[model samples]
Target chain A: MRVGLDVGGTKTDAVIIDDDVHILARTRLATGWGVDAVGATIARAVDLVCGEAGIAREDIRSVGVGMPGQVAPGSTRVAHAVNLGVRELDVTRTLEPILGIPVRVENDVKAAALGAHALHGSGSGTMAYLNLGTGVAAGIVVEGQVWRGAGGSAGEVGHISIDPAGPPCRCGQRGCIEALAGGGAVAERWGRPGALPVRDVFDAADAGDALAVALRDDLARGVASAIRVLVLTADVDTVVIGGGLSALGDRLTTPVAAELEAGAEASAFIRSLRLRERATLLPAGSPAAALGAALVGRTTEEVLAHG
Target chain B: MRVGLDVGGTKTDAVIIDDDVHILARTRLATGWGVDAVGATIARAVDLVCGEAGIAREDIRSVGVGMPGQVAPGSTRVAHAVNLGVRELDVTRTLEPILGIPVRVENDVKAAALGAHALHGSGSGTMAYLNLGTGVAAGIVVEGQVWRGAGGSAGEVGHISIDPAGPPCRCGQRGCIEALAGGGAVAERWGRPGALPVRDVFDAADAGDALAVALRDDLARGVASAIRVLVLTADVDTVVIGGGLSALGDRLTTPVAAELEAGAEASAFIRSLRLRERATLLPAGSPAAALGAALVGRTTEEVLAHG
Candidate 1:
């Protein structure tokens, strides 16, 4: 059995999977501050899964973790995680010896992409996966391998500048797609005077609120623009949209699909090709990051064997 | 020995290299319309190089050509080239027989990235090569391999939407980066009344014309925005600027570097990372696309050997 864990800003989600890719058990708990507490929370979730499944700890062969931040290969240290307020935390060292199993960690978006890719059965094709949650980002998979650029930062679709003078981005650029259309931006635009969660903004949009509708459309445009960028740049045939915002459903996908079609026709090279869109509206029931992390471990093994 | 050829909108350039990587011979000629004429022009250039270097056609080894459109592997059949006014032209079938050698073709921008990666030695790391010429596009190189997404369309930076409602792009989007910053757009903006080329605008900017200065600044901002996108999305350590517009020199690079520095510190993920700015100026000696094409042939050899 393989154990998968997803550590988000607010919650730690865990799942256990068998060789056939069936979920054996799952658990969730609030994510605590500090690296040690977070590690303990994850451990509790794992233990709960094992207990619920009536299996001993030894039955779990490998543990995979997905978190929001930079992950170095063959190490558990999270190079940096901005939202979680953690940096350089040795997750493998802290969790492995305690859990008595080999552990692996990966960036959450990359894990999500793997999960989405696996779900769609398009593992052989190049896939671009975008998650529009607190922040917008992408994990690009080309022929089953994640295209991490020089510093493991290749799939940063959020930072692609959409406007040279539109709005100031958190990254200090003017008019990045993330700055204009991410969940935080949407909430800030449509939420009440007090800072409301992004969910409420979607609720308002669904309820036919004008401001909310406009905000949603704006967000859709951002999504479409991102898809265009992906299509034109990566020439990936399939695009998977996931994250909290995807719950808006057709409001996001319909417009994004249209935009992608339009962008493809604009480029001579793209015009001859057709692009396909896939929906990842819900987080995979399994801890995708964890599974992907496990896959990473397996890939490392293969590489080592070949070398 | 390797040969690189770049076929631009106005000109065709060829460079022949010795095994020691020294330029053995070079030639340039105007590009002609129709597949046959273009093939003949290329053949003439290859023959000139072989004759000058006292080499047989067989000793020439491999040939690489960069054109302005999509290309298939192991063949020179350009799938689509809007600027070149050709579709599915079997360039390899037409040229290889004439030259009696192996030939490889790639998208001009991808070839430029390959060339920049090899010539400047900056591409040894994660590198993003942006070409600002008749059209703007990017080529991403990671770990010495070009990252071509699903359909070989991975670096169309020009089509990344900047405005959903700003201006109509040829791709049917409103306010794509290409619509705003491509050389055609610059020429259109500066052409007013006389319809001068973009080069005239750059010359005017150098001569301290007010309108030219404004246009130059706008162009700089556009370039800066692309750089921001490159840094944020790719986390590339080096950016190689090429294409005809780069001929503007410091009038472009100085402002772009400043803007990138200002923007990098704004992101938590980017803040801790050091972004290095390499030479904005490429070697004026060789056309980047042609050099890149030669490297593409070399890459094809590597891929064939490994396969």
Candidate 2:
């Protein structure tokens, strides 16, 4: 069986899958987000996932882990992950001994794109997976492969300057889409000091809360702009929304679709590109990133290349 | 020998290339911008180029042509070319009878990308050719192949809205980066009627005219944003500036590089991306599109696919 691990800011998910892409077992646990904690958490989750499947850790062919940061090309060393406070962690060396198997690492968003495309892509052409959770970014799939880009930064679109005069992002840029529309931004703007979750904020907006209404509208606009940028620039055949905010589904896409229509009405080129028709939502409970991680590395060379 | 033709708004350039990629013959002439004028113009250029090479049309392996607009896949039928007042013209069908040879068509900017990569790319990875002439757009090259996005709309980044409150573009969109920075927009903003060309706008800016400085600054910002978009999203290894504006060279890139440095100072991710270092200027007067168009088709299937 193959092992896939997705390490995020709030959760660490692990899965075991057979060659046919069937999930044999899975595990989800809170992510301890520090240098030592991250490594331990991933190791525990891997052990727990293997145990659940009643499989020996030695039986696993390889471990593929996806993290939310820059991964050194051809290695599992994570250059940095500001959110998780990870710096220069060599995942391959650290995990290879514990698991007694080979390890491959990739950026979380790129892995998610690969997963989304593997499960949902028809293999017709290129597609993008837009991840909206604590942060917003996109992973691009070209010709059935993840476009890792020159510096391994292909999918990092979270900090694009959406509004030059808007609020500042954690990355020190101002008016980024992530700051205006990501779940973290929404929670922060609600000013509830973690008392109100992102879902609660959305629920309040649905119930006619005045501030929630405006914030929701702005969020929709930011998401809409993100979609436009993806469609207009990359011209991907489909854009699947994944990550945490994906659970919101139509409540988010409805506004986004409306915004697209409004823009298309004004621009013939936009209308011709058919941006709205290409937007899709990931399945409700599937671990897209983990599955993608599990599915990658059909060969050792490919695994290293993907890393 | 291979033949290439670049059909532009103002001029048509043709070149013949030997198997060694050396230029055997070259020709340039004014292009009339109507439907019939476009076809006849391309036909005349082909005839002139062949005559210059002292070869019969039948001796030419294939003729490749690049134009600015949407080219129907597998054919030379132009869907629309507003700048040239041409629509639905089948370049292959019309030019084949005139030139007595096979023909392939591609977007001029995309062709320029191929040409630029062929002439300058290190073959390390993806690269972009940012053409700033009558309009602003990009042509992406990956692994020495043009990446025509899923919808064949790849590298068309001109119409993206940079500022919601900015001026209007010819495409009926408001505040597009093209409107803020493209040659057409620069000429329009310079407001000297036919007296001031785009080059003159830069000249006035260099002479320290107040409006010219502000416009030049805005153009630099728009171009810098274009670079950021290319780097952040596609992560191309290098971006070579081409087209009419490329003649300005450092006069333009100095400001654009400055803007990039300012943005990088604010965002660590941007700094790490090394967007500034990745930016390069295409050498002056290389006839990138013509050369690319000439060397584009080595096989019938490849030619049709490129079309």
Best by lDDT: 2
Docking class of 2: medium
Error of 2 at A159 (Å): 1.7
Could you report the DockQ of all the candidates, in the order they appear? 0.48, 0.66
Task: Encode model 1's per-residue lDDT on B24-95: one tens digit a residue.
Answer: 777788887766677777787777767777777788788888888777545567766766666667777878
The candidate that wins on TM-score is 2
What docking grade applies to model 1? acceptable
Report lDDT (Cα) of residue A276, candidate 2: 83
Measure candidate 2: CA RMSD: 3.4
Off by over 4 Å in 2: A30-33, A54-59, A82-85, A207-210, A299-307, B299-307
- Candidate 2 per-residue C-alpha lDDT over B165-265 given as tens digits, one digit per residue, 9 for 90 to 100: 77788777787889888988888888887643666878888898998888888899889878887877787889888988888888898999999999989
Q: Give the chain B TM-score for each candidate.
A: 0.85, 0.91
RMSD of each: 3.8, 3.4
